[model samples]
Target chain A: MSKQIKGREIHLKSRPQGEPTPGNFELVEVTVPEPAEGQLLVRNLFMSVDPYMRGRMNDVKSYVPPFKLGEALDGGAVGQVVRSRAPGFQEGDFVTSSGGWREYHVADARQYMKVDPNVGSLSAYLGVLGMPGMTAYVGLLDLGKPVAGETVFVSGAAGAVGGLVGQIAKIQGCRVVGSAGSPEKVKHLREDLGFDDAFNYKDGPVADALARTCPEGIDVYFDNVGGEHLEASIGKMKNYGRIVLCGAISQYNATAPTPGPRNLTLAVGKRLTLQGFIVSDQRHQHRRPDFLRDVGGWLREKKVKEVETVVEGLDKAPEAFIGLLRGHNTGKMVVKLASGPA
Target chain B: MSKQIKGREIHLKSRPQGEPTPGNFELVEVTVPEPAEGQLLVRNLFMSVDPYMRGRMNDVKSYVPPFKLGEALDGGAVGQVVRSRAPGFQEGDFVTSSGGWREYHVADARQYMKVDPNVGSLSAYLGVLGMPGMTAYVGLLDLGKPVAGETVFVSGAAGAVGGLVGQIAKIQGCRVVGSAGSPEKVKHLREDLGFDDAFNYKDGPVADALARTCPEGIDVYFDNVGGEHLEASIGKMKNYGRIVLCGAISQYNATAPTPGPRNLTLAVGKRLTLQGFIVSDQRHQHRRPDFLRDVGGWLREKKVKEVETVVEGLDKAPEAFIGLLRGHNTGKMVVKLASGPA
Candidate 1:
């Protein structure tokens, strides 16, 4: 109880009007509180920056509460337990919690889930074997329901979830095509991720690229970037196609309301099925074991690879997040809060 | 094979640019050929005009093929077998077939299904007991999946398919709300069709009207008129809601593509599902018996009432179809070709 330590944490300085800036976040020094009864004190090693956080910056009511101004912004983080006043937890135990954007946190031990350090790198828990990974796994398998021999198309294919989505579709014996913002991302999709075809949507019309790449028509679409990408996917969908509404990163930073795809009416004639979902929904809890088993097996077999862009310090979290919105990251964007046990 | 009779049939003179005009259809007199072996010569008593027909009028690839220029348009019609060379069909037998917009047709008997006149009126086979009725049955129950006590909202509630959707939801023990084009249609929805609430969409903003009517938010939305109605329904949907995409009568005649609901992105956070379908899909064929049993029993018990707007004469079929797109008909809109046996 006498031992005291200082730690740095990132707080929401002000809500962004549209596209977030570095000034919207502030780094401040704070005391790392001692673990209370039934609680544990954790020293965070890594914190994740995701596209969905932009929606919480707004004051509107959503599935999750908005980030309060001048308060610490929270998300996925992985850390090691430094002190524990709770049962079933010991010093040096690695765990993941929704206490990100900080170097350390003290909370009830139940709030954290222990992770296997031997399975993946500590940062991998925040990306590949974590929220983003589960999103890709469940969204594609449970919702998209891509069958073998069917053509599956994904947008933002170089990102963490999209990259895994393409690989998983290939594993299911499907023809996979992907679209990304840059030629480098497209090349990575084809050569590294083994997508059947990849295209840089910025070079030409998305519809033309889809037409040339997916001549057989898309049976499933993993939508990471909405707007133009969604419109083109709908136009090219085969009859009874499934569109997984995973993320709409392209429209998150728009100052004004973004227009939806104009050809959406084609869903009727084509009998397409479009579904949107949240990973944390109670209905998805039962599928977690399946996700862990399948994705975990893939990692061990080297069938799915983990890709990440890491920033050095918690102070640079705002920069990392802003860059994430700008599509600067090749995969998952995470900030390294502290060095874990060597 | 020598007996001949004069009959009038409608032909697609040209493709309409936007809204269809009377000039696009040409009524021409033709000789009715005698029935060949395994064929039946039928005299049509009634013909159906549905919103889906508008899509076929365009020279585009859809679920059904586009009508060829100078060829007689075909759709659902109820008729009596005037002469038969087929073993299954007999003279004076009533049947329904895809040989509409004509006074007489000679086709293989396999193309037609015999109808029991005691179940409903001859024109009801073209409306309530026919294709439109089945569209409502399968779309709402199979796709929408509205559970009892859930709130179901339907657009184009006065039209053929939409009207049946509302009543079916009521029979499922759901709180049904509906939107129509006119005051009379709205009143009919609330009073005669037993909808929980009804609104005239032309009287005010659809969003405001939906907010007022569906205070608890919608669990299922049966979409017939797309455009504004679709957008409003999406905005008012509760979490995990199902949207049945039946028709987009609002945009069927648009010269340019219509934009989808901007709030469609909310589907991700709310976990909504949207599915579109055609009634003739092979997958739905197995559900015909269930539809006939439930809807037929409802008709017999007077739990679901049959309502129709009839246009006289085969020459008026094009006008009836054009009026259907303009929201000029309440319930089902059908054209009477001739009188049935007294």
Candidate 2:
């Protein structure tokens, strides 16, 4: 009976050269999967549209495998376990998995993690309480190594990872500054995110803006946009500074090879350490319990605020993802698959 | 009586656009000066010819000041004190100072370090026990962070810094490979430096050589020639490899802006860390004591051997430096200003 139910799915139609086109995706109806031995049948409540998914579309070798043409696209998703063949999970349990961009998914019990709806909103598990939040926490604290009274600058400040990085650095007693593409995003960063200063990189030279905001010099630079942001950050870095290369959104859609800063020689004179890291490489894996505990407390105490943009349906996921690449979203972007209670 | 003695000096006549010429240097004569308060009058013995001096010739912002035309060129030198006015140092003592390209120099006593005659040869202090040695030790161990059983590659294998770096990595239980310009240097790297493998970079494509030599993939890369050597190293680096950007000898003479490698995006995929460092900025200041203690012990124990090209007179200093920039010398290049005790 479950196999007869139809599910909406999105599959990769072609590889993108620069910005992805709508034609690169194919929306189709497929038979909904039934729970097999040790598996759970999930009704997806919310699906995540993230920047990292862009790399999967390319054929180049990366940390993650490239998404193959004619295969369903997969990313983080919040869902409800409608039926379970595994002992660990039961019917009506809220869960999350590396689920496809679809209305329903079936996976082994081990792949789906139980989500506590009582803790917060279900979408929060896909953003602030999930991978993006963890990336910001680990990348800034562990790799960036910001100290008290130091000036910490973050690029892509309106995005999921950047927004959390700014707040976390501020909580660690650093004077935080951020950069975004528009005036509205800059306003959100300064007014809502508690960033000490914010700037629109689209308006003027980022290096000049950095020089004006960080008079003393930047101690730790958490870079989300690599190309020009990396160059500008290199110029304003103080002696013995640290730069964390977490993401490179600026170069994702670049049609040609991105020309990096010619003044990278400054790294020697400044005694700078420019490290490129992925959150999965962080040392404290078993410490996540403590992380979620502390971050959860901080959220309740109003120390760190969460910001997100919700697109109404799974049908709009490709559009939302494309908008994310163009800096159209204010914060974490998620696709709402179901209305209210799971 | 000191004022009556004539000193031979080499002055910078003009800046060179590419390869330096004899016209770029002027050999002049000046009267030797008497020792003043807290100063020592020294008869120079050996002066070092290093690749870093090439940067000083250009009118660009760097770690050190540029060589001003019409002024005498200065560098690391070993000398015998002829007269002294400060406490602790005395006449006939062998010492090292920021001695200029001259037969005689008046140096502040505080600027000179007393050398132990028991520590092999005085010229060793100008190479293995000096800045180049410290640079190799700190940059490889601290920044490159080569672990035992890892593969390490060093460019400019015949030069002072690269030779020492390869040997030190070997001592740390790493498999060391090196790239040099000539067959003789390659032979020297393999036979004399005890490198696991060595190649002549001028023979073929460096990336192919690297791929052939480093099958397990390079974990640490000590970069001395940045352009093509850096590009090759990046291609063969393993996940989480570390690259120490010690110098870029290839681009120092480049008239136009050097175009960076097209595959620079590999840094993000491999999660590699590329850091530029001047040995002077090392966080661990005790490297001097540690280096002298360890390298001095190694010399006595016959664990490491050093080679040097000793030029005849102070008049030849400028030519020797020019030759060094052109890769004319193997091992450490130094100038002998006066006859030794023999």
> What residue runs in model 2 are displaced by over 4 Å at the alpha carbon?
A1-4, A282-284, A340-342, B1-4, B13-19, B59-61, B67-70
Q: Give the range of the ten consecutive residues with the poorest summed lDDT in model 2 chain A.
A: A278-287
Give the clashing pairs for model 2. none
Each candidate's root-mean-square deviation in Å?
1.3, 2.4
Clashes of 1: 0
lDDT (10s digit) by residue, model 1, range B131-248: 9999999999999998999999999999888889999999999999999999999999999999999999999899999999999999999999889998888889999999999888
Q: Compared to the true structure, candidate 1 yields what TM-score?
A: 0.99
Estimate, for each residue in A31-108, the C-alpha lDDT of model 2 and write its tens digit.
887778999888899999888899899987889999989978999999998889999898889998999598889888
- Candidate 1 — which residues are off by over 4 angstroms? none
* Alpha-carbon deviation at A38 in model 1, angstroms: 0.6
> In candidate 1, what are the lDDT values of residues A34-131, reduced to their tens digit?
78899989999999999999999998888899999998999999999988889999889999999999898889999999999888788989888999
